[model samples]
Target: MGVAWPFADRNEGFREGLELALDEINRQGVLGSRIRLIEKDDKSSVTDGLTIAQAFANNSELTAVIGHRSSAVAVPASKVYDHAGLLLLAPSSTAPGLTAAGVDRVFRLIPDDTQIGSTMAAYAHAKRFNNVAIFYANDEYGRGLANAFEDEAKAVGMQTVDRLTDYKDLNDLRRIVAKWKLLGCDAVFVAEVMPDGAKFVSDLRKAGMKVPVIGGDGLDAAALADTAGGAAEDTVVASIFNPFAANEAVRHFVRSYEDKYNEAPRKWAAQGYDSLKLLAYALEQAGSREPSKLAEALKRTKSWQGASGPHSFDGSGDVRDMPIILKQVKDGAFQYLTEGARANE
Candidate 1:
């Protein structure tokens, strides 16, 4: 088995999760043969991810791939895995195009950006933020999320004041904030990964912009507080998993993870564990290493319980009827906004 990420230093939670998951799998003897994981760092580059994925696909020893965290990397890397007839399970990539691309071998543990977008729009409506502005990363993940949010906002009769897209540049973010202010946006929705999202928030604060900022799962990384500093307070985000959850299985996983890593596991870690659990279940049901059989078994997976949540793939190979959670940054930490809290606006 092999696990790939966009970068080595950037995704500590994801890396820790991959290591912990492999250890658990080895201890449980889930595979008849001892499973070994090969880690590859793509440096968050699409070309590098595709290159490594192609190489892995050609390697007969690697049964499947666990990642390529960003949708920017997952989109192209998935094509390589598809060509080689290997399954690629993305732990964090939420770009809707991955599942909708009509690729048979690609699957994701998290809901697509469209789902998150709809949830964000619903939250905006609930909060009565009628005039919304969108800021995106200018990449596959950002652009897709912005587009989804825009569509949903329009559906709910909310007016979109501005749509700003920028590459990984802080100066561009300053320009966008100025534009949003001119457009009279009441709330800002940022759709970008941690790096850019954190920087945008920090810069917005430096510019003395106080409009509420809402983000998708990409902003759930631990670095958000450090990067955004005191400015991160009151920021809202949508997530698929809650590490502070009290579920029995989640508590066990959290305790085990803390004992091993000396820190609370983030959503990425939970996602990695969930992805491996799904893979193991498919392999167990197939009882063979053949790609065709394993893919079929994976599609047939229904109501499988995972550390992240209960997962069931729809006919389109996407997780269906997934729930989304809203959290707010308070005292420099993320707190789950209860149903009533969110409903009460």
Candidate 2:
């Protein structure tokens, strides 16, 4: 297996998640031999990701990969893996375009941007947010999510008051916030990754915009509340995994992860762990490490339970009917939100 990710300060949870799963799988010796993970750091850069993909493709021994957290990287890198006939399992890249090309061997563990963004729009509409502003990064993940939310918002009869990208600095952010205030925006949807997403939340509060803040999985990080401080309070996000889930697998993962890492696993970790678990299942089903067989086995997956949730791939290699839930930042942690009660447990 070839594992690649940026491995940046805030992104280490993803690597930890993969490592934990790798350790468990290797201990079981499921393949009748130890699984050796060939790791690389893509730095979340498209150029670096493509370079790494080509290198991974060159390695004839490598049958599969779990990597490239950013869609900007994964979208392009996936083409390389597809042509090489290697299984590319994306743990976090939610851009629809990642699998839209019908790549034979590419699969995504999480629900695509459309599912996440539409869920947010539905939640916003349920909250009676008549008009909303969108703040997104100028990249594949951001643009895809923003467009999806806008489409759903329009369908829900909620107007998108303003949509802006690439705010250069705090001054620029405040200017955008002022414009949103003038536009009578009642909610803000952020489509950015951590540090950037955290900064936006902090700046939005500094700018004194008290309107609701909603975001996709990009903002659902352990570092979100830590980086944004009290500003992160009440921020709502669409998340893939609920850490507080009562499922035995979830509870076991949480306990084992905490025991090993001395901390709770984030959504990225759960997805990463699922990627490996699902891949192991594919390997078992195929009974061969051959790339084509593994790809076919993966395509046939249905309701494979993991710490994250049930994963069933569609014809396009996109996870089918993956659960997307609403979570709120409360007391410096993301708690699952109960719809009617609006209560955090």
Candidate 3:
């Protein structure tokens, strides 16, 4: 396994989870040979990630590469693996066109931004928020999700007052909030990562706009709550994993992860664990190190149990139509909104 280490602090949990899975798989001798992990720091930069990926592609000992944290990095870096016939398993990157780039070698563990976009739109419409305004980052991750949300929101009889993607200053966000207020938008959806997402929400609150601010996974960072402070209250977020899930798989992962790291595992850590486990399953079933054979085995995966839940990939290498749940930051911590949860809830 080859893993990308951008910010060690941000990815240490993922590394820990991958190491745990690596240990288990090695102990079980699922691969017929002990699996080893080689890591590099992309520094979360696109250029650096690409360089790291190129290095990994040349390493004949590695059968697969595990990550690139951001879509910006993953989209381009995945192409290297595609041409090299190496499997690239993305645990966090969610850009829409990743697997669709004619790259059969790329697979991601998390739901795509497109899924998140549709989920957000449907949730807003279900809540009777007919008028919406979106403030999304202008990058691939944000833009892809925003476009999907726009399509779904329009399809569901929701009215889009505005979709603001250009804003460099706090006053720009203030003005956007004021415009949304004037337009009487019932909800505001944000598709950006913090602290930018948090800054927007905090500024919106400071501007005295009380409309519900719903965010995508880009805003799932803890900084969003800390930066937005009281403004984060009632702010809903769309997520694939429910940390509070009572299932045995989830509980066991939570317990073992905490026991190993002396702290709770982040979403990426659980996803990293699941991705490695899934890879191990494919390797065991395929009984080969060849990429094509491994991929064929992986495509047949159905309802495979993971820390997050049961997962199966669609033809496009996505977990299409997977359950996306809504959670809110109540008081300070993220609280599962049981009041109007989705069917999966």
Candidate 4:
């Protein structure tokens, strides 16, 4: 397992939830044999993930790997798994291009950022943010979403005033904010993860760029509201799970997670729980450890009653359907607003 462990609670939920799922799966006698899970820290870096993937691929006993929360890590590391004929499943990692045509070894349970970008663009247009600037992380996930939103922005009759990459440093972010401020953009779209996205917005506020800064799933965490403090107010993003869903299953998962962790579960925890459970079902169905057989078995999944939502994998290994819940930071917490969130309407 690979996650950004150093980063506060965002990815910590993933690690804890996955461990709990592994325990349950073992107790139920799934996987035909007692399994041992090894943990590795990718640090959410592409280079580190590549090294970790190479190590896992070289191990013959390793049937599959549950990893790589950041799409930046998944995109490059997946090639290693594909070449090694290992199944790489992720709980997060929503970049669309990772599962594009001809990529068979990688699969994700979350909706890709392509839909997120389009929905965000639509929200921007609906809110009349005609001229928006985009600042994205310099990685596969960020680049993929930046392009997706740029395309959708044009289709929705919105103009992308400027697009820049985060240099991942305070000085670079300060410079980027200055550039966007000078361009007179009505709003900014951030395509980075929790820490980076929140830091970007914090700097924007410090520099006095007060336009409604919207983000993707990266910013859709309670930690961001806490991390960005007052700067997170009015900030919006899309989410994968809905805590307010009245379904008993959803409620049960939430209750179990809260009981286990003493904190309300985030989408990361739900997806992490389902990813391993789904893999157990596929293993039982396949009755073999061969990567090819496991991949095929995973593909045949029409639906899995995920705690996040009902998920069906597409031919390209993306989810067939999942609602994107738009949320905003209010009083230092993430508050669910509506389904298919529009801009301030």
lDDT of each: 0.80, 0.87, 0.82, 0.78
Q: List the residue pairs that clash in candidate 2.
A: none
lDDT of 3 by residue, 79-124 (tens): 9988988998888888987888777878878889878898889889
User: Using alpha carbons, what is the TM-score of model 2?
Assistant: 0.93
Please report, as a residue range, the 10-residue window in candidate 1 with the lowest summed lDDT: 336-345
Candidate 4 per-residue C-alpha lDDT over 6-121 given as tens digits, one digit per residue, 9 for 90 to 100: 23423657767777677878886765575567777787777877888888888887888888877778877878888888888877878876787477867887878788899899
Error of 3 at 154 (Å): 0.4
Error at 127, model 3, angstroms: 0.8
lDDT of 4 at 91: 72
Q: Per-residue CA lDDT of candidate 2, range 1-345, in tens?
A: 998898764465777788888898899876697778898988888888899999999999999999888899999999999999899999888999999997899999989999999999999999999989999998898999999999999998999999887767778778888888898999999999888899888988998799989999889876899999999999999888776766788888888899999987878788778888788889999999998898889888888888887889888999986778778998987788844323343
RMSD of each: 3.2, 2.3, 2.6, 3.7
**Alpha-carbon deviation at 267 in model 4, angstroms:** 2.0
Give model 3's TM-score versus the native structure: 0.94
TM-score of 4: 0.87
Query: What TM-score, over all chains together, does every model reach?
Result: 0.91, 0.93, 0.94, 0.87
The superposed Cα distance between candidate 2 and the true structure at residue 302, in angstroms, equals 0.9
